[model samples]
Target: MFVRTATPEDWPAIWPFLHRIVAAGETYTYPRDLGEDRARDIWMLEPPSRTVVATDADGTVLGSAKMNPNHMGPGAHIASASFMVAPEHAGRGVGRALGEHVLEWARSEGYRGMQFNAVVESNTRAVALWRSLGFEVVGTVPEAFDHPAKGFVGLHIMHRYL
Candidate 1:
């Protein structure tokens, strides 16, 4: 698989899985009923912030990630990112490829560290992946997320110094 910067045209491919994942209300903190226009505005970030997609040899997009400053001004040195992988492509390393790409982008852009502001604690696969990639759970807000099946769950704040 290959990873590359995403283009506006790529949204067509990204939205389906993005919608499915967010609507599931099991992982992302995004509103479950989030609409297409708003989702596009949030996901398709502008310059300085980076967005990328992981694709197969045939150029089928398997996953996507967006990386940027966790906060503005004085907090710009710290970076944050979000990832979404097609369900059919899960466990195939699509998310890992996107994770590595985001870290490399952050480092190359001179970020001091990467912070994940709202990782759903119940998403064990993601929590494990982030931990394996060197992120630590610095803190977890107790019962911060409203999971569909798990009722209320924690939101993990993960970080890794570059």
Candidate 2:
């Protein structure tokens, strides 16, 4: 697989899966019915933030990620990122590769650390992956997510110093 910067033109290919993932409301904190333009604006950032996509040899977009500062001003030294892998590609290590790419990007951009603000407790696969990548559960907000299948679940704030 290859990873590269995402362009506005890529949105058409990305939106289908992105929309499905957000609409599922099982993982992300985004509004279940978030509009297309708003989602595009969030994904295709302007500056001090970036979006990337992972593709197979033939250039099929398998997943995508967005990386940015965890906060503004003095806190901007810390980085943050989010990832999404097509359900069909979940077990193939695409998420791991994308994650590693983002970490490398963060370091190259001079970030001091990486923070994940709202990881759902019920998303065990992602939580496990983050832990395996050296992220620790820094905090948890009880009942922060209204999971459809799991009822209300805690949202974990995970972090890793770079």
Candidate 3:
């Protein structure tokens, strides 16, 4: 798979998977019914932050990730990221490629660490993946996320030093 920086033109291809991921209301904290325009704004970040896509050998977009500073000013050295893979392509390693690419990008961009602010505890696949990538569950807020099937679940704050 090839990972490349995404352009505005890439959103059309990215939207399908992005919409599915957010609409699930099981992982990310984004509103379950988040509109296209709002989702576009958040996904297509500017300058200092970046978005990237993972493409197959045939150049099909399998997944995407967005990386940016975890906070502002003094806290800016730490990076944060979000990922979304097409449901049809799940378990095909698209997400792992995007995750590895984002980690390398953050380190090369001078970030000292990485943090995920609200990882849903019920998303076991993501939690395990992040752990394998060296992130730890720094803290978790009780009943911070409302999982559609699981009712309320913890929202984990995961972290890792670069």
Candidate 4:
């Protein structure tokens, strides 16, 4: 699989899985009932910020990621990113590809570091993936995420300097 800049044309392919993941209320901080339009607005960024997709040889989108400044003004030097892999496409290295792509983008863009503000602690796969990509848990807010199956869980603040 390869990663590329995402386009509006890619949203349809992205939405179904995005909807499923957000609705599951397991990993992401997004509301379980988040609307498509809102999700689109939150995921599709512009200018200095970017969104990308990982697709197969046939151009089927397996997963996607969005990257941007961790904060505005004084904090803009730090980057932030989010990722989602279709459940059907899990365990195929899509997430790793996307993570590597985002990190490369951050480095090329001169970011000081990449920080994830709300990684659900119970999402071990994601936590592990981020760790494998060189991120460390800087902190965790206890019972910050209301998980559907795991009750209240910590929201990890993970970081990796570019």
Separate clash counts for every candidate: 0, 0, 0, 0
* lDDT (0 to 1) per candidate: 0.96, 0.94, 0.93, 0.96
Error of 2 at 66 (Å): 0.3
Question: Positional deviation of 20 in candidate 3, in angstroms?
Answer: 1.3
Task: Write down the worst ten-residue block by lDDT for model 2.
Answer: 41-50
lDDT of 3 by residue, 1-162 (tens): 899999988999999889988898888899989999999999999989999999998989999999999999999999999999988989999888998999999999999999999999989999999999999999999999989999999999999999
Candidate 2 wrong stretches, greater than 4 Å: none
Residue 92's lDDT within candidate 1 is 99
Candidate 2 local lDDT, 1-162, one digit each (tens): 999999888889889889999999999999999999999988887677999999999999999999999999989999999999988888899899899999999999999999999999999999999999999999999999999888999999999999
Q: Candidate 1 overall Cα lDDT vs. reference?
A: 0.96
Which has the higher lDDT value, candidate number 2 or candidate number 4? 4
User: C-alpha displacement of 25 in model 3, angstroms?
Assistant: 0.8
lDDT of 1 by residue, 70-114 (tens): 999999999999999999999999999999999999999999999
Predicted structure 3, TM vs. truth: 0.98
Query: Which residue pairs does candidate 2 place in steric collision?
Result: none
Better of 1 and 4 by lDDT: 4
Instruction: State in Å the error of residue 94, model 4.
Output: 0.4
Candidate 4 Cα errors over 4 Å, as ranges: none
TM-score of each: 0.99, 0.98, 0.98, 0.99
Displacement of residue 143 (Cα, Å) in model 2 is 0.6
